[model samples]
Target: MRFARHRTDQGPRLAVLDDEDALIDLDTEPDLPALLAHDGRLRSAGEVALRTRRRVTPWAGADLMAPLDPPTVRDFSTFPEHTAGVVKMLDPDAEIPAEFWEIPAFYFSNPYATVGPHDDVEIPPGCALFDFELEVAAVVGAAGRDLGVEDAADHLAGFVVLNDFSARDVQFHEMRMRLGPAKGKDTATALGAVFVTADELADRRSGPSYDLAMEVRVNGELIGQDRLDNMAWSFAALATYASRGTWIRPGDLLGSGTCQGGCLAELWGRHGRDHLPPLRPGDVVTTSVELLGGTRNRVVPGPPRHEILPWRRP
Candidate 1:
């Protein structure tokens, strides 16, 4: 079943898509996270809501919001091609870390900074090289600890298109000290208007992920396109790795990182920075995935950076 969270007079309300492609308001359920937490309630609840047809809104007109405010976001670098492209860009002769092939690597991102699929994103303060990451995110439906790859897939609730916005300059600068991609990435992340259940993608299953077409556009011009099947690490492996010493909780989000050629930095590496400039204040970035829908975000200006005293050498 496809679900969404949309704005209403009361607040954000959960809705399920009917056969007609209209949103049937699930008046009782508050949001996707709440519905998923009820274990064994999603299908019945959605079915009942569809039957009642309490309030049906045209999908095109509904004011969509992010499916849920995730408790934690683990953005995993699951595509070796993307990693290799980026590593080559950073240092042409440098080889990818061997450990990357052995285990899935991920970074925690700010959950509170998430924005709705259609919301506007602000350029990070003092950021000159703004970019967008086209990726898919799996929302955890159940909780588990130290799960194996086989057991991990069972915990998935659904999938949503994720755009992990970045500030290349800030990211590179901080990573130079080998500590961060924090401030550069924490500014914004755009989630979905449509959340598709695991069953919806069952037929398209290829290898570990679905054979979904992923694309990114800037100002209506297609910049990157790839298949989700290109990911080296499966979502289950990522989830299992994430649960190695920690717990995976309901409402937690796991991003599949950037697809190959999904960001300007990668394109710049292949082409040139001069050929493709960084995002500007009014630039629009749209990322889409098959079945999961898409997110359209406009870039806007942010506050200027506040300078602080530098550390003094002893």
Candidate 2:
């Protein structure tokens, strides 16, 4: 089952995407066990909407807010290519630390992250290079920890496409701490357009895996493409490792890092192939995952609307 939040003339509402028709009033479905006790209509309507598909608008609606606005997003360095390219991309020609090999690593994003489809992202003026990453990320539905390998999958709620935008210049220059990969990555992150529930994909375990074609276009020109099934680690395993001790609650987001050849950083850092070109004002970057959905963000040069300049007169 695919879940989506949209806006209608009637105000913001959650709808279930049923191909052509969307099941209405599904806003409270996720909190079913609790909502049902207080609001019967919400429960009844949700059930009806899921039972059958009806003629409805194509999941498109007014602006879509972040599915988990107050979300806890953690990015994991799960892929091997990412590990190998780190030294060259950042430290280059520097001595290798003995602790080069580790299980995996991650960082957190503010939960109040809010952005939507087609929103214009203001690129920081001093930044020279801007890049995009395509990944499949999941939202945590339940809480669990020290969970056995067999009970892993149950903790997942759904999945969505995550665009981990990076600033190559800042990253290489600022991160002397050897921890960050942060200076480059902290600029912005794109999630949403839609989230497909785990049930939508079959047999998540036995994938070689399935290669759903992926593509990224800058200013409408194609730049990246490949399959997700080829990744070194699967989503289930990533979640299990991440939730080892801490409680992963509802609304926490976990990113699948950049997929194979998934972003400019991964490809260029390894092959010395000019992976990063640079992002300028008025650039429209779009990324798509096969059998799922596509999300696009535009680059605008300026400060965010909410940011007040220091010299703006007291």
Candidate 3:
């Protein structure tokens, strides 16, 4: 089932995307997190809709929000080709860390900063080089701790296309300080307006990865494309690794990271810095995944640089 969180006169409500592209009110639950928590009952409303076709709203008219605003967003680096491509552009001789292959590494993101499909993303402050990471994200279905790879798949609710908007300048600078990407990332993350339930993807499931085609286009021009199966580590591995003595809560988000050739940073490194211009105000970025759906976002320039950080001031 394709589920989404949409804006109604009352407020954000859970809804199901029907075959006609209409949104049927899933009045069964208050919100997505609550609905997912009650597993068995989650699909009750969809079944009712199929039988009764009630409370249907046109998808074009309904205001959609991020399908699920996760409690905690955990993004991982699982694509070796993406990493290698990035290194080839920035540091040719750099080797993939042995520890990277030993375990799936990830970083937490600001969940509150999520933007819905077709929304405008404000470029991060002090950033001139902006980029996007085309990937897929799994929304955790239930709370779990110390999970094993084999047990992780059962904990997923569904998948959505994820855009990890990036500020390359700020990111590279901060990473040099020995900390992970922060300010460069905390600004924005775009998630699909529609969330595809896990059961919907059963046919494409192969071990831990899905045989899905992922693509990113800028202003209607295709720029990045890759197969989801190219990942060196799987989402199951990422989930299990993340649950090592840590709680993987319902509504938690885990990203597949950038697919190979998924972002400009990798493209710039692989081709040339001038191969494609950095995202500018008025530019539109759209991405789609085979079963997960997609999102379209326009860039809106932020305010000019200011002295919020006195150390950088003259």
Candidate 4:
């Protein structure tokens, strides 16, 4: 089932997609007992129209927030296409470390920002190239450390779609100075339409992207797409990597970065506008990934201030 959190006059409640993909109210009798007790005010009201088998507010009508009330967000570099293509840019003979062939690698993304589907994205003014990255993210259900691949399946709470919006200009500039993926990759991030829980997805296993297919379309033009099964690292590996010497609590999020050929930067990048154009007003970008879900966003020029660190300046 496609589960989402929404707001109504009554309060915030939980919602799920019916067989028809319309929103349904799960607040009545059976469903609410346990989820409500555990989730607290974090939950949203249910969609009653589904009970009556009628359409009241379309999925588009409600405010769709990020998939989970995430406590932490870790993004893994598991996309082979992105890795290989980027490496080839610096050296044709470049190769990933032998250790990489074994498992996943990751980095932290801001956790405080709330994102929703179809939300208008603000492209920071100075960026020469604003790009879209299509990826998958998983929610943690169980809290644990020193977990193995055999134990990974039970820890995941659900799955959601992710659009790791990037500013290539700032990213490359910072990297050349031998810095980490700071300032450059952390300015902004987007979450989901809904997070389909573990019970909903079938054939779950350890894989880079859950065998899903994803595509990125800008202003009605198909720009990028890829298959999820092509990953270089599995989710279990990511979980293990993140859990190393740290406590992983329930509600942590692990993201599988852009899939193979998932973005234009891997295909015909840099010299072409298709790969390197600065986003402008009226640009609509849609990320569609199978199983997990999809999201649509429009680009707008960012605010006057060039940059603001997430925390206040000293």
Candidate 5:
């Protein structure tokens, strides 16, 4: 079943999409996280909502919110093509680190920075090279620790399209210190208007991931495209690795990092820095993944940068 959280006069309400594509209100839970916290609640509630057309709202006019305010957001670089492209861009002769191939590496992102599908994203302070990453995210439905790859799949609740907005200039500068991608990435991350249940995608299963087409556009022009099946690691592998020595709980989000050519950085690497300019105020960016749906965000300006104290030598 397809689920969504949308704004209503009462507040944000959980909803399920009916066969006609209309949203049927699921009043038992306020949001997806609440529903998923209880075992089997999502399926049971979804079934009941579909059976009794309690309150139906047209999907076209509903005001959508991010499916849930995730407790944690872990983004993984599981696509070798994107990883290799970025490595080459940084150093033409540099090879992908052997560790990248052996482990499912990820970085924790600020969950507080999440925005809704149609919301406007602000360009980080002092940022000139703002970019967007097109990817898919898995939402955790169950709690588990140190899970194996096979057991991890059962803990997945659903999938959503994720946009990991970035500030390239700030990112590279921090990485030079071998420390962060912090403020450069924490500014914004947009999620779905639709959260698709894992079972719904059974037919598209290919290898370790669903054979879904993914794409991104800026100002109505297609800039990048790829398939989800291209990942070097599967969602289950990522989840299992994440659970190592930690707890994977309901509402946690795991992002399949930028798909092949899914960001302007990759295009910049392949072509030139000036080939496709960075996002500017009023520029619209739309990222879509098959079945999971998409998000359309407009760029906006942020506060001016404030200087911090300069580093002092001891």
Candidate 6:
């Protein structure tokens, strides 16, 4: 089932997309995770909406919020092509990290700063090379630990389109410190308005991957595209690794890192920095994963560079 959250005069409302593409207001909880905690309650709510046909809102005019505000976000770099592409751009002489092949690596990111479909993302101050990483994120529905791939799949509640926005300049500098992506990534991360249940995507499963077409468009121009099938490490495997030694609770978000050619970082690394310009104020970005949904966001100017100046020793 396709689920969503929309803003209303009252507050954020949980909703389910009907067969007719209308949003049936579940109105039980404010977000997806809360509803997910109720077991089969979400599906039952969908059934009631279809039968009653009352309070059904048209999908066109609804204000979509991020499908889920996960408690935590674990973003994994599982696409070799993206890493390889990045290496080609950053330093052709450098080889892809052997650790990436040896183990699944991920970083914890801010969950509080998530934006929804049609939301406006403010470019972080001092960021001139703004970029977007197109990805698919799995929403954990149940708690588990030390799970196998198949068991991890069972723990997944659903999937959503994710856009990991980045400030390339900040990211590059911070990584040199060998610690964070903190300021570079914490600023903004966008998710699609709709969340598709795992069962809904069962038919699309191939091995441990989904046969989905993922793409991103900037100002109506298609800039990047890739197939989920291309992921070297499956989502299940990543989740399994993340769940090790700790409990993965409901509402945790696990992301498949940037797809091949999914961001300007790799693109500029490949072609030439002069070839593609960074995202700027008023630019629109649309990222989508087939069957999940799409998120369209407009870029807005941030604070003056000086206003957000980072700390430095005197």
Candidate 2 lDDT over residue span 1-314, tens digit each: 55556655665556566656443446344432123223234335556676743324454444564444434678865556555665465546634344433444567754443466566776754677777777767776666777665676677666778877777776777666666765467557776666666666665434623457777888888877767776566666667777888867666677777766666766566666465567778888898887667679988886643543677776
Candidate 5 colliding pairs = none
Task: List the candidate 1 regions with Cα displacement exceeding 4 Å.
Answer: none
Where does candidate 3 stray beyond 4 Å?
Answer: 309-314
| Prediction 6 global C-alpha lDDT | 0.87
Screening candidate 2 with a backbone cut-off below 3 angstroms (N, C-alpha, C), the clashing residue pairs are: 171-184
Question: What would the per-residue lDDT of candidate 4 be over residues 1-314, giving only the tens digit for each residue?
Answer: 56765666656555677665656645532222234335432233333435464333457677665645567888887876577765654556766566556667676777764367767887765765677778888777667687887787566667788887777777777779877566556655777677776666567443544666788888878877777777777676777778877867767888888776556555534234445455567788888877777888888887664555776656
Q: Model 2, residue 99: displacement in angstroms?
A: 6.8
**Weakest ten-residue segment in model 6 by summed lDDT:** 27-36
* Model 4, global lDDT: 0.67
Please write out the lDDT profile of model 1 over residues 1-314, one tens digit for every residue: 99888998888888889887798888585656767887878778889889899888898899989988999999999887788777766776757689888888888999988999999999989899999999999999989899999899999988999999999999999998888789989899999788899999999999978899999999999999999999999999988998999898988999999999899888776566776889999999998898899999999999899887869966
Worst 10-residue lDDT window, candidate 2: 31-40
| Candidate 2 stretches greater than 4 Å from native | 21-23, 27-46, 50-57, 60-62, 82-87, 91-102, 181-183, 203-205, 208-210, 271-276, 304-314
Lowest lDDT block of 10, candidate 1:
27-36
Better of 1 and 5 by lDDT: 5
Show model 4 residue runs off by greater than 4 Å: 26-57, 90-93, 97-99, 204-209, 268-276, 305-314
User: What's the lDDT of the predicted structure labeled candidate 1?
Assistant: 0.89
Give each prediction's root-mean-square deviation over alpha carbons. 1.2, 5.3, 2.0, 5.0, 1.2, 1.8
Better by lDDT, candidate 5 or 3 = 5
TM per model?
0.97, 0.79, 0.95, 0.81, 0.97, 0.95
lDDT of 2 at 261: 63
In model 5, the runs with Cα more than 4 Å from the true position are 311-313
Comparing 2 and 4 on TM-score, the stronger one: 4
Give residue 277's lDDT in candidate 1 (0 to 100): 86
